[model samples]
Target chain A: MSTASPVLDELLDALRCLPGVGARSAQRMAYHLLERDRQGGGRLATALQAAMQRIGNCVECRSFSESERCALCAGSTRERSQLCVVETPADLAAIEHATGYRGLYFVLLGRLSPLDGLGPEELGLPLLQRRLAQGEVRELILATNPTVEGEATAHYLAELAQTAGVRVSRLAHGVPLGGELEYIDRGTLAHAFGSRLPLN
Target chain B: MSTASPVLDELLDALRCLPGVGARSAQRMAYHLLERDRQGGGRLATALQAAMQRIGNCVECRSFSESERCALCAGSTRERSQLCVVETPADLAAIEHATGYRGLYFVLLGRLSPLDGLGPEELGLPLLQRRLAQGEVRELILATNPTVEGEATAHYLAELAQTAGVRVSRLAHGVPLGGELEYIDRGTLAHAFGSRLPLN
Candidate 1:
């Protein structure tokens, strides 16, 4: 639909840049902001501008940060001997929220995807390698997702950790704690069965 | 999740002001923009700021416009004898897209809802009244939705049109074209049956 206002049209078009928003959703958002939440709209614009212009990767962990090092990297509470590698900052946040791990993190920002032109250099593996070569890290935990690309990235990182004389580990793959065996997918069930451990 | 960057956190919070977005969606949108589409994010910020700061309601139709009069109201191609009243600019766009109605329009921007504090004055009914009293509009078309509040607003508009000595009409209500009667809802089927017309 052709909006009577060119600015409204432009706003709608721009809103489609969001991840899941389409033309209809963009229209609703535009109308909603214009009708009820102009102040919120202005705030969003300011926030977006500030974030896009200022936010950059942390030099140490490669996670999003406004400064040279992220808070986790700059703080003294986290252990320097244990470093966890993850695909994105969101994954890093998930680990921090769900686990009691008090270690440093190295954010890959993306998994290994050759078709998309992301490689070791793009994932900042050289920086991670230099950190490992410094001999501060005694353990390297591979916490990338279980997808094909994630597995490949994890495999590559495992080799890197071994070459640097650091112990490497990966997240376990099995049925979830509350999952019923009957409902579990075949691949997971098979893997869990094959890798079943003896009772303690 | 607590983002490492304050600006990123602010951006995520401000994104929740949109109609259907929540925490997870906001996080995903922020990550996507930061990871793959910073340029698009910057463009959206610019567009949103311009729209929020500059756009205002057209004095004639009360639709969103940059200037005092909207293009539809200022143009001379449409017929002044017929005026179509709608509940929102989106509804007006739908009518313009679906039909060949080359007539003027009056956007209510909202319907009559006393509970929500929307009334005739809030809907700019006084401006509509003055336009009707000008003796230019011969036919008034009520194009509000079929909801309860929409029907109430349409009834109120019909009365105003009659007081101004203009012929009032409403869009026909019936089973939708190409809809199967067996699958239609009882309310619509019953209303269509009761308001059945002679074969044309």
Candidate 2:
């Protein structure tokens, strides 16, 4: 967007890169920044810089944190011996927010896809095996999503952990929270049916 | 977002604050930044700073610009005597992209809203008057939208310009280009009826 003004144009162009934002939104945000909150905008700008500077992946779980370990990793209550492995931090958050499990996490950062050339190495699975070999973990819970890649990744990881003399379990299959039965896809329903458990 | 790491948590929190982004999208963007584009993240942080440092309003038209005057303000070709007033820079861009008018612009930055205590003073009518009094203006175009506040603002500005001994014109009202009769709103259809033009 080449506006008559160069600097103003640059600012607008930069804002356009944000997810779902357009030229109009960028202009409105820029207008709000200039007219409404110079002090807040300055703080926000500073905060953005400081955050990017400080944030990095933790050595153990690959979760972002200011220090070498993340808060969850450092916490005493979280069970380190029972690792719940997932594909991303958002998945960790979703599981935590749901809150039935009381274990620590191992973020795979990605799923294995041979077609995409993202195998166990790409998913940091070799490191996971080494971490499991430390003889700390008892049960390895495969908590990945129910997609084809997720199922494939889970099976592959289960095989790896079994070879290392550890028990492997997956999060139970069922109707998801807030799921509409009518809207539920056929594959998920079939899985739920096949993996049905007795009522407690 | 209390990750063992404070930096990563803060970054995730900030990213989540962006409009319409859910936890999933936020984590994806965060991972993308961490794994692939740390330098780009750093550059975005700096870009935020640079935009704040450089962006200021155009004196003549009151839109954002790098210089004291915007590119449109400095342009020799834009008609100084023909000023088209609008509510914001977004409005200006919408009109520009629609691509008919060929004149200068004056951004009011807001609209008249009695409910919000946004009267003539709040809408920068005084600044507009100052522009009219500068004597280069031959015709002042009320190119504001035909919505309630837009109409009220246009009428108010037209009255002010008339009192200042300048001519006033309004954007024509009718069905929009590429609009279907069934889809046209009742108000627009009525306005078109009232202001029916002679057949060429």
User: Chain A TM-scores, all candidates?
Assistant: 0.96, 0.88
lDDT of all predictions, in order shown?
0.93, 0.78
lDDT of model 2 at position A14: 65
TM-score of each: 0.96, 0.90
Interface RMSD, Å, model 1: 0.9
lDDT of 1 by residue, A40-117 (tens): 999999999999999998999989998989889999989999999999988998898899999999999899899999
lDDT of 2 at B11: 62
lDDT of 1 by residue, B31-130 (tens): 9999889999999999999999998998999888898899889989899999999999888888988999999999999999999999899999999999
Question: DockQ: which candidate is best?
Answer: 1
| Candidate 2 CAPRI assessment class | medium
- Give the 10-residue window scoring lowest on summed lDDT in candidate 1 chain B: B1-10
Which 10-residue span in candidate 1 chain A carries the lowest summed lDDT?
A: A1-10
